[model samples]
Target: MDWPTAAVVIVIAVCISLLIIAALAVVVGGKAAKGLKEFDKPTTRHTF
Candidate 1:
């Protein structure tokens, strides 16, 4: 294979990997945010 062809293949592989990682990050982040929201209730404070 030519250098250009190899380079293009590598670039495509890198892009696809990046896209998969980004998608997983979004999914995990959304779940984490939802969990955090569940704990966002106001807490009572006592003054001494």
Candidate 2:
């Protein structure tokens, strides 16, 4: 492969890997939020 072609392929691979990482983070964060919500206590907010 030419240098330009190789560079493009590398950039594409990096972008894909970044996307996968971001997706995993979102999934893990959601699970954590759900777990914490179960233990959340109800609170009443007074408005002036």
Candidate 3:
């Protein structure tokens, strides 16, 4: 439990947490985009 070793461990832990968060964000965002796309529809106009 030297200072350098503790620092390295802390940094690694932070990096892993950040990676997990990023992955979850991508998954959730993709699902949200898919849901929005499903509700998206094209509009048509009729003219005389």
- Candidate 1 lDDT (Cα, whole model)? 0.86
10 residues in a row with least lDDT, candidate 1 = 39-48
Query: Where's the lowest-lDDT run of ten residues in candidate 3?
Result: 39-48
* RMSD in angstroms between candidate 1 and the native structure over all alpha carbons: 4.2
lDDT of 2 at 36: 68
- Once superposed on the true structure, which residue ranges of model 3 sit more than 4 Å away at CA? 42-48
Candidate 2: pairs in clash: none
lDDT of 3 at 23: 100
* Model 1 regions lying over 4 Å from their true place: 42-48
Model 1, range 1-48, lDDT digits (tens) per residue?
999999999999999999999999999999999877766645422221
Instruction: Give the C-alpha lDDT of model 3.
Output: 0.85
Q: Per-residue lDDT tens digits of candidate 3, residues 1-48?
A: 999999999999999999999999999999999876766644322221
Q: What is the C-alpha lDDT of each candidate?
A: 0.86, 0.85, 0.85
For candidate 3, the TM-score is 0.82
9, model 2: CA deviation in Å?
0.2
In candidate 1, which residue pairs get closer than 3 Å at backbone N, Cα or C atoms, i.e. clash?
none
Q: Cα RMSD (Å) between model 3 and the true structure?
A: 5.3
